[model samples]
Target: MDHDIDVFAKNYIYQKSILLTKTAQRADWDREDVVSELTLHLLRRRDQFNPGRGSWTTFVKAVVNNRTTDLHHQLSRQRATLSLSDPRVSRVAERLEDIERLRHHGVSIDPESDQCDRTIDLNNVLSQIPQRDRRLCDQLSRFRTADAAKHLNQCRSNIYRRIVSLRKEFSSAGLTDYWK
Candidate 1:
């Protein structure tokens, strides 16, 4: 597979195209378009493959599945054509867009329309972090990792260490879906 990426890709596409028919039907997308999207994704993310961890097929399969789901979301968003000009409808639409944007950023919100629960949950979970670590997360939101490290007077590795510990706590608290 070292020098035969194209050959491997062609073989994979031929084998997988049939399986993607369901994805096409569910997402209201074209089979050819889905195949093209997955092929491009594989090429772009090929360097992420780790031979020691798994085979190329496993990695490609995972990527293909993820890309297919993303395609579904993309198609759903595109097909949503609400022309609600009412004040309440506009507000609801704005909130829905905000929720979708947050989900895209890996912040899991409750599926229900009540965003208050999401806000409370997010605050409760974040409160578990130490003040210093919370500060690091805030800085991370506003800066690159290196810049955040500099601002915090810590090494880059320390920043990463804090992030890992923070995420572990988030996962332990059953907020894993919100860990980005």
Candidate 2:
């Protein structure tokens, strides 16, 4: 039997070994060292790898999961050194308290409000355009810019220009004048 492995096998083994090692060592140890060791181990056992047994992907996934579990247990033992008195935890709590206080003061923060207003303004502005421009704008807004360009068969720059034009129209129509 020829001892030389195919390029696909070599690449598959190398990538899987690295992922396995990283998943294993990320919790407590340096991921690089683990990857190096795993690389060497895979290279050494390359001859033993059989295509009939299972896929290289499955084998690598299993190895990664096993290594990750081992590292988790190892790190869990070491984590006892850390105490709850860490200042970062207190800072996070303080920030949460501030948010709660704002809520209590009848001041609500809605993250989607800006997006909703933009969407409403865009719809209103689109209605004023001819049917073709209105349809194009609606399609463009469905995707931000890049996605809209691809979907609408327009260049990214063209999509941006259209959006700008729509915005100007909305402004002129007093749709956003209420914000002033």
Candidate 3:
């Protein structure tokens, strides 16, 4: 409650909240909830307001419009899980029944072959690195550059040169994207 919201700001929030709920059409999103969220956002950002830059009403309208649209877009990207009928259920059942009749067996799918291969390749590459340089690699994986240097009792510039060396080794091993 940095300052009281003027009548104009209250009106803007009310109007925008209705529009937001109608546009989202989400059962979870009531008009009052949207209004509260918008009001809270305006209040939280009040410290950013500069009176010399603009009018109060203009600031209210701008903040309401931007925040309302932001909430709407966020709500749009989220959806309930597929708890209802699934189109592939019948097809999968039929395939399973055929397999059971023919050989009394079920199916197993491994969708992680590529991931497994990459992990194994990375480990192989890491094993070939010497112990001294390997500590930097291990530390860098757990922390940012500065923190990694601190953990290894080295300076930032030393950490940078070690990083360049590691990157070069990784590049030659054909796992260049792994560092990033």
Candidate 4:
């Protein structure tokens, strides 16, 4: 009887994951990842499923709904954090560089203007560094050094080197104290 219940539970978990994935049908949510998360969740909570309180299918459905909601929330939070690395920043930065080039060719820009002034401080500082270094700096600011290293697929020492390089660039641009 126990073996039968175990097989039934596993089958239900897989079926629920397939239903959720089909409803989503987006590339962001891998079917396997969702299935594995649901599987782990059920395994951990197996003792909580009581046949006396509810039908087995009802209990399984509740677990499926809860796990799917959690997965959606986790993906949403990840997207929110990743929005900082959007391409819009690079596009705006490129336009700012064009304005700087015009200034270099003797076209005087009004430094007091809001548009130009917005690019004068930290944006300018970040624009001066290589793209990889800029991303490294951003990651380091948001996460611990070890975490940043793991995210970038680099060693801790490499992360530290990039941090030193970023600090030097910021110091040269008079934005050293801004980050703290």
For 43-138, candidate 1 gives per-residue lDDT tens digits of 888888888999887787787778766766666556433446546688776666766767778877776645544554556666776789789878
Please, what are the lDDT tens digits per residue for candidate 4 over residues 1-180? 121346666787777778767765545566787888887787666678778798767776788679888776666556432233457777666767867876887766675675455446566777777899888878977898899899999999988777777777877877767556
Report the Cα lDDT for candidate 1: 0.71
Q: Clashing residue pairs, candidate 3?
A: none
User: What would you estimate as the lDDT of candidate 4?
Assistant: 0.72
Across 1-180, the per-residue lDDT of candidate 2 in tens digits comes to: 223444654565456546654544433355566555555554565555567887665555454445545545665555433235666677666545655555677656453575444444454566568786676666754656687678778788876777677667777966654323
Instruction: In angstroms, give how far residue 171 of model 2 lies from its true place.
Output: 0.8
TM-score for predicted model 4 compared with the true structure: 0.39
List candidate 3 stretches off by more than 4 Å.
81-180
Tell me how far the alpha carbon of residue 146 in candidate 1 is from the true structure, in angstroms, after superposition: 1.5
Best-performing candidate as measured by TM-score: 3
TM per candidate: 0.35, 0.28, 0.44, 0.39
**What C-alpha lDDT values do all the predictions have?**
0.71, 0.57, 0.78, 0.72
Segments in model 1 whose C-alpha atoms lie over 4 Å from true places = 1-115
